[model samples]
Target chain A: MTRFGRMWVMTGLLLGLAMPAGPARAQEHAPAAAAQAGGHEIDIQHHIGDSHEIEIPFVGIYELPRFAPIHVGGLVIDLSPTKHLVFMLLSALIVALVFVLSARSIAGAQARGRPATGFAGAMEATTLWIRQEVILPTIGPHGDKFVPYLLTLFFFILAMNLFGLVPGGATATGNITVTAALAIIAFLVIEVTGMRTLGPKGYLGTIFYRPHGLPGGPGGAVLKVVLLAVLTPIELIGKLAKPFALAVRLFANMTSGHVLVLALIGLTFLFQSYTVGLGASVLATGVLLLELFVAFLQAYVFTLLTSVFIGLMREAH
Target chain B: MVHALMLALQEEHTSGPLTVEGGLMLWTVFIFILLLLVLKRFAWPAILGAVEAREQALEQQLAEAERSRTEAAALLAEHKRLVADAKGQAHGIIVDARQLAEKERAAAMEKTKQEQQEFLARARREIDVERDRAIADLRREAVDLSLAAASKLIGERVGTDTDRKLVMDYLATLDGGR
Candidate 1:
């Protein structure tokens, strides 16, 4: 922020601090304080963290019904519904519904010999762009086969990310586990396709490939084998690191935006002045909107990297 | 899920944002799998098929349109060629007709000129014949008169055949010389 903006914020916060309310502040700030003793850090975590109950700001908290009531030696499976799970499921259903409706209309258009319209047209444009520009360019020659998977990944992640910005929603992608699972799926697809294309021996050789031409001798053969041994782990790590970075990049981006938004809101509570809170909220709105853009950008990045990884794995050179 | 960690967990160890609980992970994976299965089975095939079909249709339509254009151009060129051929034939026919008429006209004029020369020669022949006949008659009369006059002058009549023949012969010689 500029100096003028900062002064304005501080003035608002000072005015907010002049207000008086004891019990509500103490009660609200209690859970927040458990994370960070004093400061805006506590509320930020409370906002993004997964919880047993769905907390709606205007509406009261609604506790999820628990499943698997039996406890196995005081260590339950903990396989009950969560706020994250609800929102995640909701996001999935929404994505499915949108695509299903669009697909049906498109299919109908094809049947009747008419042009695609409205949402179907939009979906068509996006699908075609991904096929031609994103997937085809990256995977090369017959890269079109990967379109379904990439489309699923792109739209799925995009929907989930946008869902997080809802009034009473949690970011499913913000969770490490979610990002990790997605990355794991992408990794499996990459490896399987690589193995399918290159064959087992070629795939293994690619992992340990040495560019230098080996001299014709027993000693040179031994040296080449040794060099391969030395370089194999590095190559393997490099392969694994692509997916790892993909997961972290998405998780960090999604989580950071929520954190920023929360912290800004928490600034109002920190000052205990409604005027300062208002000013902070006004400021946070900009970032909140930016989060929407970041959500899309991060989803594109994840899908793009996955494409690049798949491309890298499929091509021997 | 109602994990005891939320309300009564330690702030220090649990403070890290990267920590993963088993429950959330399981749910996420399960939900994702369910989503993939549902989409792959129901949604993807339909959408991808439609888009592919539409694209192919468009390509086929475009190709057909191009073929039609080429056929039209060829037909136009053929029509133009036939028109040009007909025009050339008509021009040739006109030239032949004019040449034939010119030949007939020249033949008729030559025949008329020959007939005029023949008629003039015939008239000259008839005139020459008539003039010769008149001269013969005049010579006869002159011979008879000359004989009569001579007899009168001599106060004698020459009744001998030889005398008449001699005078006639002398007249014939004068006529031939003239």
Candidate 2:
């Protein structure tokens, strides 16, 4: 293995061990044991309730806040920072590293053996499959052009989702901010691709022009205009709704999976039974596996849908 | 089913509204946009171009292989044709050799028959000449015998003139008959 490959493997191993075991150990030891062991618990007191936080030496702080939030205009809004951003960055880095390594393998003049292997190969196969099977088919002639965007989105979302499943890791996608940002990016790409394909005037005109099958000229034009005006907003609303939908879909999936696992785990604590605890732990672990699948699934779905939406937008009316 | 899933998701997120600070939201948007632009410019084009180049290279290799196969087939066919022609020429040579041998044998037989006929004719001519000489000798011997007998028949003191007259008479009669 190259030095880079060895480093990634080490990093993956460290992350694999650190992410789950650290949280589990903290949960087991309790505040008293942790203090006895000379471990300090950084107490992050918030508006809702007091929660225990953990701090890594070089890494940022970690905490899980309560469900309650600050209300504005009858809307309860969450303002606390979740571990979601850290996971998001980590996932992005992982994806970038994998692609960079794969790209390097291809760029090298003398590449031996299989082109795809380890994490890099797996990622390449997935991206190629999506580009060929999903994006190109949906997008048509220029479909290949959008491959990078779709691939990046898929990996980025996937990494974040997987990270969330780790015990101490938070779901960045669960936060509206992260999902909304991703959605906006999709929205921009779709619009830009559409604008580039259909000139700006043509794109705008599509919103107002309705083809007429009926015969009274002025009346037809008027009726068409009125119908188009109504449809335009609806179309616009649908466009807005897509990214919102994407964000919510991913956020909800990650959050629900976490919540379910947490609830299952909490049952043992509530009942104070060793058998129940063990059973719940087993169930939670199974759910965690399912969560892993969902992480990848949601990421794929989000990227695929975005590509499809962009493809549709780029089409001639 | 999709609707139900969406509804469930909504219900789960309904617990709190996430209010991101405007500045952070703006910054997030800017960073994401920058990321997309940078990716589009730098990473994406390179990656896509590489993939395309790889595909083209594979296609070119396939075409080249096909061309080589066709050329090989053509060469094989030419070789086979040349071999067939050589075989045909060999057959022709064998046929020509047999015909020439037959002609030469006929000429030799004709020459041998002519020589034998010439020898037979020469031998026949020599036998005819020898037979003629023998006939002449026999005739001469007969004539001598006749003359002696005649002389003995006549007495010793008999007039030669009378015997000569007889012989002359015989000669005259022979001449008159001729």
Candidate 3:
């Protein structure tokens, strides 16, 4: 094998060997926690879902701080931080710090008539790629104005998704609530752009589509009514469906990868065999690698789909 | 493996993965908006501006390079033209000098030939005049000696103008008869 191939195999082997250790450690306290919860069954939900507790491998699980529920007129809002919420916050903070610093370095270098080097260079390249290749092309002309928003989404989601792969880390992007919020924002941007680009009368055409070259007078009127009656609801559904797809696609993809990895890791404990543990570890390693890819992929997909939706809205006839 | 995955997926849950926590959603919206605003203000403009400035600088540099290359080429062409002109002028100067030298040589040769001819003609004229004078002197002496010899033979004085004229006439007749 070539050097890179050999190195790759070595990494896979190491990852495989290291995979079972975390689950094994957690398994030490699994029975006690399961018993306390009134069951002795494995709860995959505890791994993928939000929790009041945060687990860090090699260190014990710690309960997050709880805040009092805020009362509105008839609604109670619990702003208490959960495991996913904490990870989300961490992802946001990390993105902010890294980008702010990278930007400073880039600007400093540029002022001296040079391109940024090192970590800032890498960050610049990535941001430029997303801006030039993904956002600019997908969202068409005048798309540069939206680069900051889309770039933030991509990096933030990417960080959240990648955090899941870390030992004892949570996947905040896997939560439907988070994905839904992102999708809602994307939907607002798309519709608002459509309204701004097309104005009131033109914007209405997207939902109440009327085909050209229809008969004049009464027949055209009847045809227009018929078209509106049939296609308007479909068009409205399509508009809602775009954001819905964006939300569900990201949530499911991010969640499924973790679920598979969790299930594979669970296999070792279920069988209680060293041979099985090794096999399960190898499998989990493969799934973990795939999860890593999915992390980047889902981020890219979310950004790409949002841009595409915006483009569609911008030019809607 | 599929059965295992299905069994795992079928496992019971307290709160399903699909459930959207309202507070979490609120937090996500707040965080996403905040991040967008922060990054937009601090990061995106600076990074993008820097990149664009760099691109413009590179483009300007490339254009300048092209202009410099064109200028160099033009300068090279002009230098070649000047060298060619200088070479042509030098050749013209050399050709003119040779032609002038040939004309001077021809003129000098003609002058020398004329001077030699004039000297020979003058010498010939002087020789002819000298010969004529000498002949006249010899004739006069011969006539005087003849006169003296005749007087001795006759035993009479014949040295006079009249005698000379008669003798000269006789001599002329005698010469005519011969």
Candidate achieving the largest DockQ: 3
How does model 3 score by TM-score? 0.77
lDDT string, candidate 3, B123-165, tens digits: 8888888876765565566567777887888888778888777
> Which order, best to worst by lDDT?
3, 1, 2
Q: Write the per-residue lDDT of candidate 2 for residues A36-64, one digit (tens) a residue.
A: 43332211111111123444423545564
Q: Tell me how far the alpha carbon of residue A225 in candidate 1 is from the true structure, in angstroms, after superposition.
A: 2.9
Better of 2 and 3 by TM-score: 3
lDDT of 3: 0.81
TM-score of 2: 0.66
Question: Which of the numbered candidates is closest to the native, going by highest lDDT?
Answer: 3
Q: Give me the runs in candidate 3 sitting further than 4 Å from their true place.
A: A1-42, A65-78, A110-114, A215-218, B1-14, B102-178
Score chain B of each candidate by TM-score. 0.67, 0.58, 0.65
Scored on chain A only, each candidate's TM-score is: 0.82, 0.74, 0.89
lDDT of 1 by residue, A1-317 (tens): 24533544455344334422111222233343534554323344555667677765435678998776446586545677777778888988998888888878888887898767998889877877776778878887887778778888888888889878765567888878788888888888998998999999978876887768788699988988888888888888988998899999999999887766555655555565668656765666667678889988998888888888888888865
In candidate 3 chain A, what residue range of length 10 has the lowest lDDT sum?
A20-29
Off by over 4 Å in 2: A1-82, A97-134, A209-234, B1-24, B37-57, B106-178
Residue-by-residue lDDT tens digits, candidate 3, A1-317: 24522443344346636653234423433454445544333456677778888877547779989889788777777789998899999999999999999999999898887899999999999999999999999899988878888999999999999888765777899899899999999999999889899999889988888787888999889988998899899999999999999999999999888777666655554664557756866777677777888889999999999999999898887
